[model samples]
Target: MTSAPPHQSILDKPFVLDLFAGPGGLDVAGHRLGIPSLGLEWDRSACLTRYAAGLDTLHADVSAIRRESFESLPPEINVLAGGPPCQTYSVAGTGTGREALEEVKKFIERLMAGDSDEEIDKELRKLSDPRTALVLEPLRYAIQATRSPNRGHRPYDVIVLEQVPAVEALWVRYAEVLQKVGLPDGTRYEVVVDVLATETYGVPQTRSRAVLIARREGLGTPSLPEPTHRAYEAKEWNRRNGDSAAPVAQPTLCDASVPGPSPAADDDLEHWTSMGDALAEPVGTQHRGRRTPFLVRSNYGSSGIPGRRGVRTDRQPATTVTGRISRFVVFEHLDDDIVYEGARFSMNEAGMLQSFPPDYPWSGTAKAQQVGNAVPPLFGAHLLSAALGLPAPAPEVMREPWIPATEEQRAKLRSHGCGTADDCTARCPRPEDQTPPRSTSRPRRNTASRQ
Candidate 1:
C-alpha cells in the first residue's frame, strides 16, 4: 500500500481529522488529493483498513480523544472533518437517542473550549459541578493539554459532514454550535444541498442523501459540482434556486458521465449483470420454465429486492448509497440448463458502487457493515480537496493492500458463481416456493434495455 509522503513541509498542506473513520474512504480520498489526514476509529479491523489505505490512523474512539493531542500536533489543521455515528439520526434509530444527542452536545462543547481545561469549566457550568461528570476526566485532560491559548481560539476553517437526507436537519445544531464559537454569523456555514442522486446524477440505482458544508472564513458555501455526463440532468426541483435548469448527463452503472471536458468512463457491467434477475422480465408465451417474474426493488422493502421503476434512468444521478443490505439489489448473470439471471451485489461490488476504489480494503465479517460504513471516496475527495484548496484525485486511483477479496470473501463469491456464467441461486428471503413461469425461451437483446 502507498503511504504518506516523506516528512517535508507538512505544514503547507491541510491537516484533517477523520472521526469514525471506517475503512478510511474519506481519508484515503483526502490523502490522494494531497491533503494530510489522520483517522480515528474504534474498530480494529477498520483501523487496519485505514492503514492499508495509506492514512495515519489511530485506533481510538473520537469521544475518547483529548484536546492535548491536537495541541501537540502541527498547528495547520485546515479542516476538522468527520461524520459522527448516525445512529441517533438514522431512520432505524429512535430519533436522537439520548446517548447520540449527548455525544453531539459534547462534540460541540469540546470544539468551543479548544482544550480540556476549558472543557472542564464548561462542563462544571453545564452540570452542577465538574466532579459530576468525572467519568469524562480523561477527555478533560486531553482537551486541556492540547489547547493552544497563544494561537487564539478558533475552529478549523472548513467542516464537511455526510449523513442521511432524512436527518440532515439535526446538523443545524452543529453549525449553530460552531458559529457560537466565535466564527462570523451566516458566514459560518450552510447546509447547501439536500438532493436525491437518482433524480439528479444518473446512477442506475436510486439513492438520496443530504451533504452539509460549513466554512469558517466566509468562503462561499460549497455548491454541488455540476454533473459531467450527458446521461443525467440537473433536476429543477421546486425548491431549487432557479425555475429552469439544463439537463445533466446520466452515468451508467460503470461510467458516471460527468459534465466536465474530461468525463470519467467505465464499462464494468458487474452491477448490471448482477441485478439482471430483478431488472429483467420474460416476454412471449406462458410457462416456459420455473423463472420468476422480475420485480423492482425498493429501498424500503423487507425482502431486499429492487422494486421501484418508471423513473427516468438517464436524467439524474443515483441516490445516496445506504448501509442497508436488504434494500440494495444486484443482478445475476445466468446460462440456461439450471436457470440463472439475477444476483445481488457482492460485498465488494457494493463497496465499489459506494465509490470506494475497486481495491478498497474492507475489514470485519459483516460485509454489510464494511460496505455501508464507507464514505464515497469520490464525494469525499471533491469535498475535502475543495475545502483545503488542493487538486483532487479520482477515487479509483487510491489503492490499498487489504482491499482485494479476502479468502473467505473469495469463497463466498465462488459460491455465488462470480466468475462463471453458470446459474447461481441467491439468498432471497421471499416465501414464494414456486418460481415465476418463464414466458419466453430466448433472451431479447435491446440497446435501450436496462443495460
Candidate 2:
C-alpha cells in the first residue's frame, strides 16, 4: 500500500455516513478534517446530543435504513463508518455474541452467496439476542452500495468499522467478503483489520478495539493508522504487587525528585498520555486546586479475585472507561495514608479522557455511558486520515475547544440550558480548608515477595 501523492486530495469533498453513531465521535473528527458527516442513530439520548452538537443526524435504526433513503441527500455518501453495539460481545456482559459467532459467520457466507435480505432477516429473527445481528449491518450496507442500481453502481470509496476485541474474528470475515466485492470496472477493495490499543493512538486510557478499514482498490490502498504514542506500561512495582502486599502508590506530580520510568527506545513516538497530564489543568471553576497524588480505585476486581481490586495512580493511563464509570472512586493520597476522599470523574472529565474536547456539549440520559462508548475523536481522526491516505492531523487539533458552527446550533444549546461553548465545569471535588498531615518518614520502596 503506497501513500497517496501529497498534492492529490483523496477525500476531496467527501461525505461520511456513520451507522450506530454514538454522540458523534467520528463526526467530530470529520468536522476537524473539513469533511461533512451525517450519523444514523436510534437512541433518543444520543440523537439529542448529536443535534445539540450541530451534527447532521438521521434518527433511525441502521437495519431499517436502506441506500435509497440516502439518495435524496445533497452530498454523495462515499464513506461508510460505524462502531456497532458490542454489549453481547463484551467480556463484562453475557457471552452470547461469542456463542453466536458461528451462526453470524454462516450469515456472512449466505450474504456472500447473494442471499436476499428477506431471507437473511428471517434467519436473524431467530437469534436469542437481536442485537447480535446488528454487527452484520455494515456488510449489508456495503453490498447495497455496490449492487444497487439506484446508487449509480458506485461502491463506497471507503468503509471503516470498530467493535470490541472479541469481534476481531468477525472483522476478518468482513475483510474476506469485502475483498471479493468486485466493482463494475474490475476493481475490488483492499482490506486491513486489527485490534488497536487506544493509548497507542494518544488516548489517555487503556482500551482496545477491533477495527477494520477497506478502500476501493481503484482509489488507493487501505491501512490501519500507525501508533503516534508509546503503549502505557505499569511500573514494575505496581505490576509485581500481589493482593497480600501493601498497596503501591505512584510518586506525586509535585515530587520531581523521584524519576518516572524510562522513555521508549523509539524516539519518533511520544510518551503515552497519562491521566495526570489530561486532568492537570482546571476545567472552568471545577477541578480547581485539586490535591496532588490521587489514586483511582476500580469498581471491578482483577483476575477473578473477590477482594482484589485494580488501582492506578494519576501518573498512569486510566483503565478502560466503561458505562459503569460512575462507580470508580478517586482518593487523595500521601504515601500510605489516604489524605482526602475525592469525587469520581465528572462527565466532562470522562469525555476528555476519551479524547473528546473538554467542553464538547453532552446532553440527554446516560451521559457517562455515551462518553465511555465513543471512539476518541483524536484517535478517529488519525484512523480516518490513514484510511484515506491523507496526512495525519496536527497534535494541537485535539486540544482546541469546540465551537458551535451556526446561530441555530447556539440557539439549540441555549434552549437546552447549556452554558457557553467554553464552559467545561466538571463535578470534581474541591480541596477543603483542612491541611493533610505530613509524613515524618520516607516512603518505603516495594520489596514485597512476588509470590
Candidate 3:
C-alpha cells in the first residue's frame, strides 16, 4: 500500500524521538510514513533488536538522557512520542490506578506550586511505588525542550504519549496542567485524549491503549485519528443481533499474513479476516487442506484469560498478544483426525499480530517480552497520521459468502474446551511416574489457576 507523499507542513518534518521505544513500533510507523525517528530505550534486549533491525536507537534511560547529547538532532524536533512504562497502571498489574492517580496529582500540584526540582524529587522519593512517578518525566522533557534556546524560536511542534487505559485519568490530569499553563514561549498546548483499540487500526489484536496528543500553540489543534476498522466485539454484538449495517471490521489474524488477497475479496460485503488466514503459511495451501480456514486448536483455553482457551480463526482477534505468548498451544488437523502436535505460532506470527515487518531483526533473550510490550506499528501509523494530519485508512475486510463460518471454525477459535488446550491449567496433575492420566477426560477440564 503506497502512502501520499509526505505532507509539507509548517514544521520541516525531522526525526521523532520515541522514548520507551520498545522494539521500534512507533519508529517503524514513522519510517514508513516518511518521517525519520530515533528511539531511546534502556533494555538490553530491546536495544539489541533495534540496532539489529537497523533502526536508529540510543541505549540510555530516558530519565537521564537529554536531547542535547544527540549531535544529530535536527534544528527542530518534528515530534516527541513515547509510552512510559505502564506496569504500574495495568489491569494485569497491581491495579494501582487510584494510588498512581493520586501521586500524579501531587506532582502536578507541586509543579503548579512552583516547588523546586529538589522539592519535587523529595516528594517523588516519598512514594512507595516509584514507577508511578515516572509518568511525569515526559512533562519534564517537554517543558525543558519548549524553553530551550538551542532551536532558536521553534519549540517542539507536537508531543504524543500512550499508556494503559487505567492511566487515562492521570494523563488527562497532565493535559489539564499543560493546557492551563502555556509553554515558556507563551504558546499553549492544545490537547486531545482518547482510548483506542489496536484492532481498529489493523493490528490483528484487541489491545486497547489510552493516547494523549498535545501540540504547542501555533501549528493548529490536533485531534485523535478516526477509527479505520470496526472493532471485533462491536461487529460480533451487531452480528448476534442481526443488526447488519455495512460492517467494516478490522483485519483478523487471518488477514495479517494472507500473502495475496483476491482482488474481488471485498466486492459485495466486507468480511473480517479469520485466525486460519493469519496462521496460513505460503509453503502450503492456506489451510493445509482443512475444510475451512477458520478453525484452530490452541494450547490456551477460551474461558478465563485470553489465549488460554485456544483461539479459533473466525471468532475474534487473537487475545491480546502478551509477553508470555509461549503458553499458547498450536494444533494440527489431518483429514478426519485432530492431532495435538504441541506447536506454537512462530515469533514471526507474533510479530505479524503486533503489526511488525515479517523480517524484523529480532534479538535478545526476552523476545516475547519485546513483542508483547510494543505498540503495533500499524496503530502507530494511524497516530502519526493524525499528528501530521494525514489520511491513514485500513484496508477492506475480505468478503466471503460463507456466512456464519462453521461451528468447528468457531470452536477452534473459541477459548477453552474442545481438547484444544492441553496441560493448560496449573492444577492439571503431573505424575511422578510420568504416566498419562488413564481416565481419558478432556485435557481442558482441570482449571485451578494460570502460572
Give the number of the best model, judged by TM-score: 2
Error of 2 at 183 (Å): 7.6
Error in Å for residue 353 of model 2: 0.7
Worst 10 residues of 3 by lDDT: 396-405
In model 3, the number of clashes is 19
Question: What's the true lDDT of residue 289 in model 3?
Answer: 20
lDDT by residue (tens digit), candidate 1, 286-390: 112213322222254233333332211211223334666535432222422232324444455455556554445555555567666666666677566545444
Clashing pairs in 2: none
Best by lDDT: 2
TM-score per prediction, in order, is: 0.55, 0.83, 0.72
Candidate 3 lDDT, 94-137, residue by residue in tens: 45445668767877756654566677877776655566666787
Better of 1 and 2 by lDDT: 2
Sorted on lDDT, highest at the top, how do the candidates line up?
Answer: 2, 3, 1
How should the candidates be ordered by TM-score, best one leading? 2, 3, 1
Which segments of candidate 1 are over 4 A away from where they belong? Answer: 1-12, 72-74, 97-146, 149-154, 176-205, 218-224, 227-343, 389-451
Q: Once model 1 is optimally superposed onto the true structure by TM-score, how far is the C-alpha of residue 18 displaced, in angstroms?
A: 1.0
Query: Candidate 2: worst 10 consecutive residues by lDDT?
Result: 425-434
Q: How many backbone clashes are present in model 2?
A: 0
